[model samples]
Target: MSCASEQTSKNPMYTISKVTQSQLTDKDIFDEELDKEITDYDIQEAAYYAQKGFRVPLKSSIILAQSGAQVPDAYMQAALSNYYNVSVYNGFSKNKSSSNRRKDKEQQVNNNYMKLLRLIAAKGGQNTIIVYWGTIEKGDLDDKTNIVKWSQYEGGKLSSKTKALRYLLKFTLVDVTTGNWSSYSPVNIEIDYVPPKIGSSITDALQIDELMKKSYDNAALLLSEKYKDKTK
Candidate 1:
């Protein structure tokens, strides 16, 4: 409830700033950095709440967004801070004939997906959620339909019909090593179903803090509803 700095240093993974809540909430001094800090807290708390009853690997779930040999540290850090499992792999793509570039790209994607599948199997199937970094066709699970693309929540534009304040986490569950994937679901943190405020549009950062606050509240509510029975 507060952002004030505390003297608790023995426990690691502490990112909450030591500044007082008043200092953090002062609008006059508010900056983009503060906005990000608050948003991160919300995300972490929401993710933490969501994982309460469900079985998840805190550090074994791998997020491979692309074919890159190395995933940036920022992504990994975000995953860790948000209580997500973190694992990764790299594979080589063969050169393709110009006529079949599309086919080759598809093949590369499939290969990466398969490699991830094998990794999940080897990891003992810790109920991993593969957070892929690409878009999936609607209701199309057979093709590359898992692991959300960057366009979903990331600066990407949303359709008018889907215009509402939400925090989305795209994931596909692999409960077992079946050498196939289940359907990917975008977890929309629906908060009260309120219309978007005119002051803040999703694309713009005019009211980013307010938007994130609403999102956090909604996510917490949804997670609570999901695990209510388990908690009891």
Candidate 2:
């Protein structure tokens, strides 16, 4: 796992994609090749959008998951699947009778999510979206389900009133033995929203002032009518 910076504004990032497996032969070479291909895709995508009069600003750093202790196999596996562009399971069944290692694996994923949440929360934007993607190598592991986890804060939950953000499902993988990083499976994360009950309403002092003015105006008008005959 990677160390998180103090400020998210210092490094705000949204990943495009990653490779799914790290066990592939010539992994380093494969990474290079994928880099080129991904770059081309990004360029072409940008050009296509530009042709359509869309303004897509590319300004985000690469965000890697990190841990202070020895990383668990589950976390590493998820990363590898993401790196190599494969599928990930949306949910992992908790094994109550499993070894301590299994519990640690589950904890690792949660920890990474918390870290990302903190980073995004620290950002200055009123509406900031963060995407957490996971996947397993195609036929490499028994669990072939594509996992694309994303943040669903209470502020963003959808109901009869509001709509949640939009995102694409994606992942990458890593090798446990060789510590090799794989290519990235691309996913998309997009969100546009306004929080409920945002901005300030009328202040108490302002409200009081308004009421006083109305009362004074009514009193003055009443007195003018009452004294009309005397004045004339």
- Top lDDT prediction, candidate number: 1
Candidate 2 vs. true structure, TM-score: 0.18
Candidate 2 ranges with C-alpha deviation above 4 Å: 10-29, 32-162, 167-169, 176-232
Q: Residue 227 of model 2: what lDDT?
A: 22
- TM-scores for the candidates: 0.31, 0.18
TM-score between candidate 1 and the true structure: 0.31
lDDT values, one for every candidate: 0.33, 0.27
Error of 2 at 92 (Å): 31
**Top of the candidates by TM-score:** 1
lDDT string for model 2 (1-232, tens) is 2223221111101111112222112221112233234668766765664454311122212223312112112323333332222221211112222233564564322222322323443352211111223321111112344433334321212332222233223222232222232333333323333334436663322332233233323332332233222322
RMSD of 2: 28.5
Q: How accurate locally is residue 95 in candidate 2, as Cα lDDT from 0 to 100?
A: 20
